[model samples]
Target: MGTEKKEIVGMIRGCIKTVTCGQKLDLNHKSQNDVVKPLYTKLAYVLGLRVSPFHRRQGIGFKLVKMMEEWFRQNGAEYSYIATENDNQASVNLFTGKCGYSEFRTPSILVNPVYAHRVNVSRRVTVIKLEPVDAETLYRIRFSTTEFFPRDIDSVLNNKLSLGTFVAVPRGSCYGSGSGSWPGSAKFLEYPPESWAVLSVWNCKDSFLLEVRGASRLRRVVAKTTRVVDKTLPFLKLPSIPSVFEPFGLHFMYGIGGEGPRAVKMVKSLCAHAHNLAKAGGCGVVAAEVAGEDPLRRGIPHWKVLSCDEDLWCIKRLGDDYSDGVVGDWTKSPPGVSIFVDPREF
Candidate 1:
């Protein structure tokens, strides 16, 4: 966990002070997105804040966030997000409570095998494991059809801190419908042994969307791919069927955009598909991290409340020399955020 340090500064009563920002960077060992794209560059998602209690209530927190916003903006960040627990009153108050940041979506950081039996077996969708080359087309389709987090595809692809990357394609489509499939398949990039983080990027259908209006040619392509993965990786756990309010599930992580009628439906279908994989594999859970201000939260209030844990939302200025400041105790091992999906499956 090498600390990638950045700086953030604040003004209190007209006096300037600085804070240190750091994050642990790694590759998503299970990422499904990296199968097709070449690596580029990306910033780390973790940011820490160290502020003094004596300086509390001086609007320093707001200043810190503003500074970080400016830094990301200047660095070509399309959008940046932070995570925190639902019950941490201070953190909750600071972000949505006081900082005026809106709630995005609620996602569970679920643990697997804890409640494997609770998973409903009837809601399975097919998932296909795609060769890196075939998966790239799905990646392009995901990019063209939706607005993804981190905004830039290159940055998301290039980031060192990711899990495994994988892609889901339709069962029979030679190519996606949006663009005719290109010749030549992508090969999986080999990583060094002992890599803890795996990046898995998947080109999946908006299952929830398909159930509503009807599946498109492109959607069918993704569905087919998902079917294949489900058959191959029986060890992964899946999310449950979504209701009207909780109409979406963890599948939104591969959503085209944050939220829409189509996006919601796509996510729903994805949940069904993932569930099938878990059942076949006998896996227990899945996890998803959602921004506090994500629009997807409009329907699922429980997810919003549960996702908040002990994680603090901290910000600092760039290029300011400073030591690490502490906002809240991160060492206490606050209540673990409960992810609805099994970790083993991811």
Candidate 2:
């Protein structure tokens, strides 16, 4: 077997930048680079598309995307997708207009910094660390309501950097205000299930790092001032700037779900759990990408509007089977299609 990393795009004239290239994705494994994108089956993922500064306005990018799509089909991939920030119109046009791809889903990636103090200080329910097998069971119970849900549960639970899985269980059999029961917790009395909320964490410190550089000195000054203010008023929730010298501790939280009032409490407890884990591991942030329409998205803590980052998911399907069991319609345009946000894609 060939061990060489495949390279499709040649180096630009006197420059090291590759014109374009992508990778074959398998959801059963973690990304070699740790950006948490997961697919249900095999697919082609276009990544790190770049053109030299001297190579502007040419058809090279379009050609590269087309060739990569062909490579996907030839390799038995049923679909291909690319993820990019929503503001990048140039890349968007190249994929949707030139390469026959369409807008599939727009999801937001949210980041929450873990401080020494607990952000989710819920006292009613206690979070219990779960074994992988039990965690998979809890995930499946909540999976049906989600789109783009991971098909391989083991990949998520057993990934090398996975910290742990957790469930929020009532502190005691009898529930009360002191017991941490909320109005929504009553639903479980009528229709009982194993637990209230479920969540898992992945450590992406080695697989990922964030970069933030200001174009001008004024912006840098303003950022520094904000950091100073954040320290002065610890509860201000200012965004943390990425340090060039230090890789931010990044842990990804995924498969988050809960029912009703208990769900809210669970979200808090789970976040607290994640924060404690991140703190112990020297991680600075815990993040997750979720569908904008998902109610759970509203629960995960973030810096109001500032911490919400949107990314466009573009997909092109190659097969004709759009039966009930299958995921999406190959015949229709990508917009308005149901999407499952895999946290691994963060």
Candidate 3:
């Protein structure tokens, strides 16, 4: 929003521009030889483009996107990206049909209830909190294992809202694995696992307060009443699922990374740990965003599927040289491109 000043607004008659650069994003890192190479390109993110309803259908959207593309080109940006809901036809058409952008990826933003449902915690894995300097260890471990991991490790570790960084590994295996268990006891690393995971918790109560909508009056009343009882009568353990009424108090996990066959198990352990932290902080839910095909999406225990909680990612190339290996044509991008979404950018 800081980019919305007078000169740029006057040029577009009422448009805004936001450009971000100087971060390296990994496109494809999966290799048989254990050598991970990155795409190494600068990204320009264009968001908050709006055209008043009174000025609709007058090629305003097309002109706005064109201006941003030109600006990105002049500023040495190789890629331009945007995100929106999958069902937004108007915005979709403006980007794909007019702006020459390609449908790059569709990622699932999973949300988990902190206390309502059961979370299966792993006994073999132990999650421990780390100091700010230990954040470098997390970056190195994940970068060696997971693909599409962001290169901006310092920003995540030093963010104002970052609670801490945590790593999940086999218990009692001090090869950088720390001690302590959540909710119960654990055993030593006897089984020589294949993978590990690292996660960072970002308190989102001040940022991501959901506003429940489209519920009947009676339903809203029932949801609130049930929540009150659930809080009061802990022994009864009544099913107080979140609905369109309770919308605040959330903690989000970013930089979810994992590898190997047992990667999903490590992810589950981290989810349980993050959930407990959120509950202690008086939060209602825990959430994260993962690419639709990433194992972390299947690894983390999330809300039931088909919950209308997914986002559409679209990208366009600003530079003429397509040597970056990004599928220039949207139709040509099979199975979608691998992506990493930095929560700080949101």
Clashes of each: 105, 7, 0
The segments of candidate 1 whose C-alpha lies over 4 angstroms from its true place after superposition are: 1-46, 50-60, 73-81, 96-100, 104-111, 114-127, 131-134, 149-151, 154-285, 289-346
Better of 1 and 2 by TM-score: 2
| Residue pairs in clash, model 2 | 36-344, 36-345, 37-344, 37-345, 124-180, 147-340, 148-340
Candidate 1 local lDDT, 117-208, one digit each (tens)? 23332222222334443434434433322212222433333334222233223323342222434233322222111111111332122222
Q: Which of 2 and 3 is the better model by lDDT? A: 3
- Give the lowest summed-lDDT range of ten residues in model 1: 190-199
- Residues 200-277, model 2: lDDT tens digits: 888888687765544477766665566566657767654554232345668888877777655766676788788778
Q: Model 1 residue 236 lDDT?
A: 72
Tell me the deviation in Å of residue 78 in model 2: 1.7
Q: Between candidates 2 and 3, which one is better according to TM-score?
A: 3
| Per-model TM against the reference | 0.35, 0.71, 0.75
- Taken over the whole model, the C-alpha lDDT of each candidate is 0.34, 0.61, 0.65
Estimate the lDDT of model 3.
0.65
Cα misplacement distance, residue 102 of candidate 2 (Å):
1.2
